[model samples]
Target: MNIVKVDVFQARLPLIEPFIISYVRLDDMPTIFTRIELDNGIVGWGEAVPDQNVTGETWHSTYDVIVHELAPLLIGKSPFQIDAIHQQWDAQILGSPSAKAALDIALYDAMGKCANLPLYELLGGRAHDTLMVPRVISIKTPQEMAEDAKRYVAEGYKHIKIKVGTDAKADIARICQVRDAIGEDAYLRVDANQGWSRTEALQVIEATQHCAVEWYEQPVKAHDYRTMRHIRESVSSAIMIDEGVQSMHDLTEVIREEAADMLNIKLMKAGGIYRALGLASLAESANMPCQVGSMVESAIATMAGAHLSMSRTIIETNEMVGPLMFTQDVAGVPFDGEQLLLTKAPGLGIEVDETYVSSITVQRACIE
Candidate 1:
């Protein structure tokens, strides 16, 4: 059960289209994929989508931390001792959550494989066999956004998350246009990505009140809890904090201040499933709903997210559409339209194709 070898593969996958949030635009998704081989010959996989704007990490930094820092700490360690490993990581590593997340996922995957169980079962067992994931429409013109919405809806997606936080007036128009194109039955949500000022957030929310937005996410900056509370109180739509809630402590603070109505938990931000479970538990205790989300990642990370999403009934939405956004997947798993079917196979329940991975891999390393 002790980790004997670790392999890190860096790959760049071209997106089906350019994904634009308020802070950044990406035409290709750069991911750090880690494979940990244990003493008994069992292998586990993990993926990291490093975003400098969100996790304060890039591919190079993530790779360096995994190879030079985290790998030595992980080698010869039992995968079952996840809590101790996490504690050591928190003690030694300060802010490289994305880097730590890759290792965390790999360890969990190894544990699941060792026990011959799926990750969701290891987390807490499955609450649902399938998850209805929401497709995200990146920032674009009103017409283009509407078209994207329509296309996704036509493809059997029932939920769509629109990116906003640019011009208040244009943002309103974008929501309204997409709402019109998708009709009233499909659920519509908007993520501002902490792109707008409090005043602008309030103005846009008020203007788009008629568009029936299910929720408004991270309207202001991540640290401005006061303004987040103000905007939440000012609007009827539920307010979800994504960038704001990075840890259990952050979630506790947001709940204590009554800053947001919902929480968006991502493995990259929370570090891994270990911390993500804590955040979800804290949010549930506070009666705040949760949404499981991820960066633009391949199937490795997206499958990890799907395990977490299915493990808890408190997660009301799934935003693990990263695999769907790409033209190809580095791994293979069953996907029924927007819903990803959970596998009974061990670990994350997906198999990584090393051949395809190597084809797209830009960098690689092995630590033994």
Candidate 2:
């Protein structure tokens, strides 16, 4: 069916608490939601979470590209021609993967709905029916973070990811305190968000060696391949590259250098499911593991990630806890305490509450 119209909405949702990372702290998330309507009355949904620090995009830029550039290109295009549309986008667009991702996810959702199957079935099949989500403890005082960790564990979370990389000593204290509070049985991971030097990364890893961290992610800068490889060689903790591994080219470089033990694949970074699938394939070929992640997004994007997480067996871990971080959900889905239950409903298998979305929306645009 040909796409007849496209609608874009920008929603600003307040977080339950300030989300602290190495470089910045966020009290709310600005997200762009997309709806693509087909001539046959079928509609698909998508969302884009623009993080200037992470995806190099802001809400305005993402909205501009989707409305002025991508929407015109997509008008009258068949939803079934997924690869062809993506190929056109790649050739015509230079950057702005998050903008492309918004449309890409919508196209996939539409296709899945047309086939009367969930998005995962179209990707492959359900390798997992439910995904174990990891709760992220944003950067805080060692004691505060420890208390947060304990609370998440008490809420039935099995996995906890700590934000670090500001100070080696503080990071050490944070990890140790959290580990002690959680009683050592829970799985723990750390993401530095490119906050440390190679030496500092090593120091932190060395100090926290006894804490049993499952992985250390993006300790050094994203482009610093030499330092990343050096840190990987020096540390015993598995290194997961997040900002460093953006596209297939970046993944190839990381694989060539053996710099990372795992990859944090976000739909925003990989430009959506199509390219993410390629990245997953390449990572699997090299026997590298992957963690499906999000950019502090809403349930629209989180459900998209949830579908991708279950689509393949290569995704060993999931950090799609964006929905849990917000004070209110703009959409509804089946999320148990630890696992996100995938539904048999068509498309992304979730429904957006348009009224709630409209209440929080700051901008809107429509192309027909």
Candidate 3:
């Protein structure tokens, strides 16, 4: 089917509270929701969450590019030429992966709808029917963080990911207390968000080595390969690079330097599932485990990531708990305890409340 119309909306969704990470405190999330209608009346939905800290994109930029550039260009193109369309969009713009992701997701959504298949099946097929994810506890006081971990554990969450990286001593306490709260049966992972120095990363990893961290994610700055490699070698805990490996080149550089033991793939960073699939495949080829991470998105983009996560068995764990972080969402993810159940619905498999979405829209644009 050929694209006939495009509708793009930018909305500001409030977080439950201020979400504190190592480098930024997010009180709300700005997301761009895109809808594409085919010639025969089929419609597909997509979302773009432009993270200034992670993807170098803002909400306005992503929405503008999609409305002024991507939408008009996509008017008559066939959604079936997914790879070629990505290359064309890449040549059309530079470093707007989050913007490009909006369209890529829409195209994939439309393609799935056209094929009468669920997105996981359209991407390939299910590696598994469900995922038990690591619920992230954002940066908080040691005791508060420990209490938060306990709550998630009480809710049937088996894997807990603690956000540390502010101070070595405090971070150490966070990990240790979380481990004590969860009782060691469930896995504990640490995400520093590039909040630590090489030395501090080494300190935390070494201090909490007894806690059995599944892996340490992005401990140092994104490009600090020397420090990353040094810390990886200095500690027993596995190192998983997040911001450091945004592209294939970044992945190769990390692999070449022997920097990390695992990978974290985000759709917004890689442009969308089309490129993320390639990155996951490359990591699998190199024998590295990968996890699908989130960018503070709603259920729309998170489900897109979920489809990609279920497409392969190599994606061991998921952090697409974005829907859980928001105070309100137009759509909700189906969660059964720790497992995110796969929807059999075609495309993204979730029907969003258009009325609720429009009520939250700060900006809206329609192009045909």
Off by over 4 Å in 3: none
Once model 1 is optimally superposed onto the true structure by TM-score, how far is the C-alpha of residue 295 displaced, in angstroms?
A: 0.5
Q: What is the TM-score (0 to 1) of candidate 3?
A: 0.98
Candidate 2 runs further than 4 Å off: none
Per-candidate TM-scores read 0.98, 0.98, 0.98
In model 1, which range of ten residues has the least summed lDDT? 331-340
lDDT of 3: 0.88
Question: For residues 210-240, could you state the per-residue lDDT of candidate 2 as single tens digits?
Answer: 9899999999999788888899888778999
Candidate 3 at residue 44, lDDT? 82
Candidate 3 Cα deviation (angstroms), residue 238 = 0.6
Query: Tens-digit lDDT track for model 1 on 1-368?
Result: 79999999888998999999999888888889999999999999998888888888988999998888887788899999889998888888887888888989999889899999999999889887568888899999999999999999999989999999888889989999999999999999999999999889989999888888999999999979999999888888899999988877788889989999999999999898889999999988999999888898788888888899989989878888888788888887578888788878999988888899899999899999
- Which candidate, 1 or 3, has the higher lDDT? 1
Ranking by TM-score: 2, 1, 3
Model 3: which ten-residue window has the lowest total lDDT? 128-137
